[model samples]
Target: MTSLPMSDYYFRQFEHDGADAPAGRKGRIFSAICQGDAPTRKKLATDMALRPATVSDLVMELIHDGLITESRPAQSLQKGRPEILLTPAPGRLCAVIFHFVSHTMHCAVVDLAGTILFETTEQVQADKIDKQGFIDVLSSLAGKCTAHIPGSAKQCGYALSLPGIVDEPGKRWVYSAYWPKLSDFDLSEVSETLGHDVIVRKNLNCELRARTSRRKSLGTGKTLLIHWGIGIGAAFISNDRELVLTEGFGEIGHCVLDPLSTVSCKCGMIGCMEAEAGLWALATMSQDQSIPINEQKFEDYLQDCTDKSFLKRPLLLMAHTLRNLTLTLMPDEIVLTGPFVQCPETFQRLTERFELIFPEGALVRKGRKPKIVSGRRSKSDELVGAAFDLFRTEIGALCRI
Candidate 1:
């Protein structure tokens, strides 16, 4: 039998003990609790090398703060003491998520457990609104939703998901042709308007990638997601569980797919992916061909379209785009998400073509064949991710306090 290394065994034991330790105890306790079953105060104290009294005090504080709850003691037949488990109390906390798209915005109030309590959407010409005007609108809506919560002003936070480049840490949107004036504006203003104590802003695609990668339905080992909406972009998760967010990454839509193609993109580029497979491209193509379609009408007609010529052109262009994305990322699985998934046939045709092009060997050596699937929770994913972002930030504040 091979003996485990002493360092490994000690580290494992330390992790187990850290679960119920005092505040000064290493962060290992929190890490273990997040990944493993709840531990008793005694076990946590032992692992953290702290006194039982200290563990008790810390656990009580956490419970009182609404961060966790102590459950009923475990059933035991023996005459010994029983152990109570700790679990997160999702209801005591809440978060607000705003998914800002080119033509509309989706807003939701979600709990810590990722449940969407209420949701609202509005259609507006995003390009026409200035920085403060957009913030005012978002703030007004958030105020209305949060008012429904009964409390002494619940701790609130906002998550902004947008399509253009964002300075994540700086909380500034560098550029987004969809809303030009939004560039160089303090995003915290939205939080002020909503009366939220905390605010977070992230690139829409990057936030989507983080949310999808964590979903169990998508199957958790390194995956990639490509969203085709007003723009086309890709997000990647590495095998080591690292989220790679490059400066201005996943701007494939701006890349010239065909310089000869006549379509012009909002980025002022001709024949780019945004000019081809993007929703605008598809909408333009349909309209130019004299197909009677509007945003709402297109959704209805897309399901019953019988003309192969009309369907074939867009599907082929989408397939080509997917092929290019696959060749570049070689993701374990490629999930097609976003507004486009609403059209089931369009999604199905794209998947069929992807499979046909790379029958085998794609993501094969990486332990699984890359599979293409549609976004399961279209609106839910964004809202949940936004909520989690808020919850996580709050947790950090509590730790500091």
Candidate 2:
């Protein structure tokens, strides 16, 4: 790993207001308890690498705050005092993860401990619904999700993951190829109606955010996730841990590959990667609407799709894109996810291509090959990352009141 003069707070997603600075230790202790099975104070101390007395002190703070509860010790046959188990208070902290898929929104209410309390989906005909209709649906879902959680549960906030250009700084969906009418739609509108601080991000970026390691690592801070859902998109985490999602990050799909090609993209570009390799492109190029455009189907269907060598051009274009990204950006890790990358053959080919081209960068530095691999989590686990984004934010506040 290249030693960057980066801050301890490397990841941008972990940055938050200083409201909870006083509760930093309490938050870490609470977060640690939320991780594995209920841990004893001694175990917590070992896990967090803190002194036994320090853990005992924080445990009381958490217990007093109603964030955790000590379970009655089990009968120990050989030991003197049975270790008391520390467990998170049931439903103490919860957040709703709104995962926006093509034409459908999967809403999941998750606790600080990463348990899904409730899950429901809302679908809309993209061609029919206006931007306001979309926001209304989100607002309604937030209310329904909030109501489902026990009143005692602290509803921290909402993490909304959507497709399209996420102007994170401005906090709005700047442009959406899937929902053309949703351009420049203010995200704060949903926050205002829902009365929650909404965390809006590119669905893929949220996937990256969600997958980030709780335990800071050498390479975890630098990652680039390339996703293939209805369209092609990329999310980047700089070495210093700043997530790159806004400022022309949306145009990856519209990047022109073949300037003279005839096919046009949904974003109105000709011969873009989305025009050739995206799910929409696959459907358009093959003229098969019956094909399931998801990760599960990609493995078997990929063989069928490749029967006619139908995947060659798209995969080649995709390899071209990754090659350029690897050369220029050189992120610590490049993760591939979504339906297309799920295919064994597709995944293998991408990895092999990266292996071949990634070495070319050695001319710059003896043999510095960046990791390029498939994402570890499935789509369902994406909500885990989304909830963690909020969890990380809340933890940073030291204990936001």
Candidate 3:
């Protein structure tokens, strides 16, 4: 799924009485501070176009609630009273992040400032676990992380990252190639069992959100991220700076490239994009060859392979798909992630092939063309993204405590 499928309650948390109301004002002020757009009371009022007195009132409420803390600047040369800078109070409100890496379930406790206060990982064979069994493991991991929350802090919420097509609003995991046994799994009861609001998101969406947040420039225009790995998927951020969260928005891997082809996809479809160029297909093709296949060192393997002719067909298919996607999205930037992008030689080849499809000056309209670059996909970023996303959207509820 392209959308970071958030739970129904997650969206409802953003509902406020009104923008002029106390709760709305406090949430906005808190978000501005979190984004570093407002660091002082005066700045908050100015940036938010509110009266200084109003800003102070809401800020005081946040501080009193332990949502934010203020301190004097260390050095101020020409000031009698040093400016009191405002920042999120560390260890006050934390988010528990749960995501899967391969078959491992990783849990992290992250604060508002994107710090991972605690982290632990457990291996779970996706194929073996039933829906309830998966929930048990998830609950165990969540319990472990939440138990570690500082005594002074409150649990803001939880974010669970699932890989596969999902029903975001329904809170259902529809299907995943890795977890064939877990289909149409109901996640509505997950929050009830965990005793907190759980926001479920797609793994790719979390990764892309993290990338956009880290690089401020990417936030201004349309950015498309394509993950070409064991399971292929995509996520897109529009020029309006909103993630396309429509349910099942980015499941390009299931797009049938050829209906007549017999190649099968894990999704039980024939001639899907993944069947043609996904990492699984590449790995299968590598078995008969002399080139060593090491999943752990896949990047090195890609670089070491002297004969790259085997990569041509897959790379061509990927390039064509990219070209089609670019034409439709017209993004300012295209980000390629996953294992294939980690290899410099392979990345260069993929870019070269993509450029060939769009000739020089062919796509240069209004002196603008999509800039393609490789991006890193890491577990830490996913966790941080999930935490930050929760903080931004649910600040109103979080500020209450």
Best-matching candidate per TM-score: 3
Compute each candidate's TM-score over C-alphas.
Answer: 0.75, 0.78, 0.84
Give the per-residue Cα lDDT of candidate 2 at 302.
66
lDDT of 1 by residue, 122-190 (tens): 777776888767776787667776766547224457777666656656666766656766766667555
Error of 2 at 393 (Å): 3.6
Residue 278, candidate 2: Cα error in Å is 2.0
User: Model 1 Cα RMSD, Å?
Assistant: 6.8
The parts of candidate 1 lying over 4 Å away from their true place are 1-39, 43-51, 71-85, 101-106, 117-127, 152-156, 174-220, 244-246, 287-297, 311-313, 339-345, 355-369
Residue 379 local lDDT, model 3:
74
Model 2 spans with C-alpha error above 4 angstroms: 1-25, 28-58, 76-85, 214-221, 238-250, 261-263, 269-271, 286-300, 350-366, 375-377, 398-401
Better of 1 and 3 by TM-score: 3
- Quote the lDDT for 263 in model 3: 86
User: For each predicted model, how many residue pairs clash, with residues at least 3 apart or on different chains?
Assistant: 1, 3, 1
> Could you tell me the lDDT of residue 228 within candidate 2?
66
Per-residue C-alpha lDDT of model 3 across residues 178-282, encoded as one tens digit per residue: 788898888889899999888878877777766665554543588888888776788887734455554878888888656786788878778888888877676
What TM-score does candidate 3 reach? 0.84
- Backbone clashes in model 1: 1
Model 1 has an lDDT value of 0.60
